[model samples]
Target: MSSPQDPYQPGQPGQAPPQPPLPPQQLPGNSGRAFPAPAGTYPEAGPFGLPGQHPPAKNRRKLWIILAGIGGVLLLVVLGIVILINVAGSATNQARGLADGFTKMVIGGQSSQAYDEYLDPALKEQLSKEAFIAGVDTLEMDESCKPTYNDLQVSTDNGVKAADVAGVITCGGKEVDLAYRFEGTEDLKMTNIKLRPKA
Candidate 1:
């Protein structure tokens, strides 16, 4: 029979045949083809290697130590400046105080007190208390004689030096020229004083 007329022929209203499903895709291997690596996997070689790697603890500690030393040096410099300022202030005060004391004793007619304050140990031993007091008393008794000292000016000259003291002596209302020399010690004591009448 003529193949029974193909009972399920397309033209004779028969169901179509089913097609096969597509295969799943796959990445290539190291066989001359590039492929994406799995997440979190890294290449053997890198442009720089492990981003932001920290320095060793020892190296970091050394850097901190160097900075600390520099800071300490700066601190010491500041402290030195403060100490020098204090010393200068103390010197100024001492000079002013000594000058004031001399002025008060002389103007107040306290010749003995003035002598005691101004004379150093050496001078005191050389000149007896009576002689020293007498000399100052003579100056006080003179009508035109007046002794005055401005504030002491201190300066460094190998050591410390006091400014020239101003002195005058008057007799019979005539001014008498007086020459004097003054010296001080580190402790600001008036260590030496000499007076000479002008010719």
Candidate 2:
């Protein structure tokens, strides 16, 4: 029988024998006792990437830059539209003034000056100065009455700007509807003139 202090001694009947304790495992670069891995090693992985790596600062900054670029482009577009509208309005007013001045000069017996200044080069090429003056003379417009314009419309087609002025003027004490078409926003010269006697 084994002594009571023997490590491998069996206990009383129906009891199992005792086994010796296991020796400590010694890894190449570690102490006898194993330690848990460092906190940085073998980081937990998630669907996107490593855990706690969601919403990176670099990606957030890029998103903000993209949004800012879009906003800047939109601002520029709005400013450009505003500038275009103002320019078009200025051109319309200029055209209206030119039409009024030209009509008054012709009816006020300054046909020579009107033909020299207001008529477009293309129109002058079609009608001689003598013919224009003769045509105005036949109208017999009252120089005392002021011409009144009812409507002025400006438009652009294929990069060409044009304006139409429609109004009424007194000729021999009779009201006459007169319409004038002017072309070119910058140069602004008269292209056509029409007179209709009102019944």
**Which residue pairs collide in model 2, if any?**
none
The collision pairs in model 1 are 144-170, 145-170
Model 1 over residues 1-199: C-alpha lDDT tens digits?
Answer: 2255555555444456545532222443445655555667654654445554455698879999999999999999999999988876676566656655664565467767777767667667878879866765655443334555433445656675554444554445544343333455555445555444445
Clashes per candidate (backbone, < 3 Å): 2, 0
Measured on C-alpha atoms, candidate 1 has an lDDT of 0.58
| Over 4 Å off, model 1 | 1-52, 55-59, 137-189, 195-199
Q: Give the range of the ten consecutive residues with the poorest summed lDDT in model 2.
A: 18-27
Looking at candidate 2, what is the lDDT of residue 78? 100
**What 10-residue stretch in candidate 1 is worst by lDDT?**
21-30
- Best prediction by lDDT: 2
Q: TM-score for every candidate vs. truth?
A: 0.49, 0.60
Query: Tens digits of per-residue lDDT for model 2 on 1-199?
Result: 5565755534556447655543334445555677555555664677678765666689889999999999999999999999989988987798788988888888788999999999899999998999989887776776675678899888888777899989888655678788899987468788997765666
Off by over 4 Å in 2: 1-55, 157-159, 170-173, 184-186
